[model samples]
Target: MGPDDAFWEDGEWVSWDEIHQQIQYKEWRAKWPNADLSLVPVFEDLISVAEDYFLATGRHLQVYGDIGELYAAITYGIRLHKNFAQGSDGRLGNDHIEVKTIAPMNTKDQTSVKLSGHFNKLLVVNISEEFEISSRMIDRASLPKTSGNILKIRWDDLA
Candidate 1:
């Protein structure tokens, strides 16, 4: 299939309605049901931007990955650190947090999670094929030894 066809078939093209129905959105709402609705317009705008980029380039952007990280950071009240030699993605008080996203449907076998830098805590965000979101947090000290830069923990190990 052509890139455009593949992009569509792969479900990378997202709409505001689809995003709103996602598990991440539900989780956000459950936590902050009283949050102002004004934030939604910005989210809708971001969806449009992602869709436009895909249509013009026929390449799936990392918007969903970014969204996953942002969602996790906001939920945990963590601040995203700059990627300049930073070992972690966000900071929770004095601890470092590494956020990882997994879309099982997009992979044949997603085994070990990868780490870029040292972190005190690890957050695994799993997005299922149906857009259901689930997460887990583990301490770096409890994990197995690292092979090169990869953690020895497998996807099943986290379950």
Candidate 2:
């Protein structure tokens, strides 16, 4: 696992890439029984838009990134709950989740994991230069104390 793929799981660091790969493998097995989906395209248009937005604006667009988060939630069978506040990105089972995405290549600051309101869980999604994606799911209680609206945890802590 790369440094960027590290995430705390069961009190130990694990590779989000490996977890996601396992999920995908199980999904494929359940969906197609024995057939392979190697040629299937997943979020081609959205990924193109994300890449274009980053290239043109020199920053990661929130809407495009949110779309990626939504895709991840769906893939993992999480239900989305939209609201203006309260950090309601989606829900995994009974846990209220807040999804945050960052493209490491687009920003120099590694302390961008900001949060407001309340959430049971935080999902930090990291997108690499090659558009490879990984995520870290952290319980809000495990996070450090917040100052004002920002959570104490940063990108460096997760990445």
Best by TM-score: 2
Pairs that clash in candidate 2: none
Off by over 4 Å in 2: 1-42, 52-62, 83-85, 109-116
Q: What's the lDDT for all of these models?
A: 0.63, 0.63
lDDT of 1 by residue, 1-159 (tens): 434333343556555555555766676568756433334445446546666676687655666566556556655666777756468788788888888776534463243545667788988776654445667788888777765777544455776
Mark the 10 consecutive residues where model 2 has the least summed lDDT: 32-41
TM-score of candidate 1 versus the correct structure, residues matched by position:
0.58
Query: On a 0 to 100 scale, what is the lDDT of residue 84 in model 2?
Result: 54
lDDT of candidate 2 vs native? 0.63
Writing each residue's lDDT as its tens digit, candidate 2 over 8-118 gives: 778787888778878876876585453333422344456667778878898765564555465555455556565555556777778877777765464642334456645
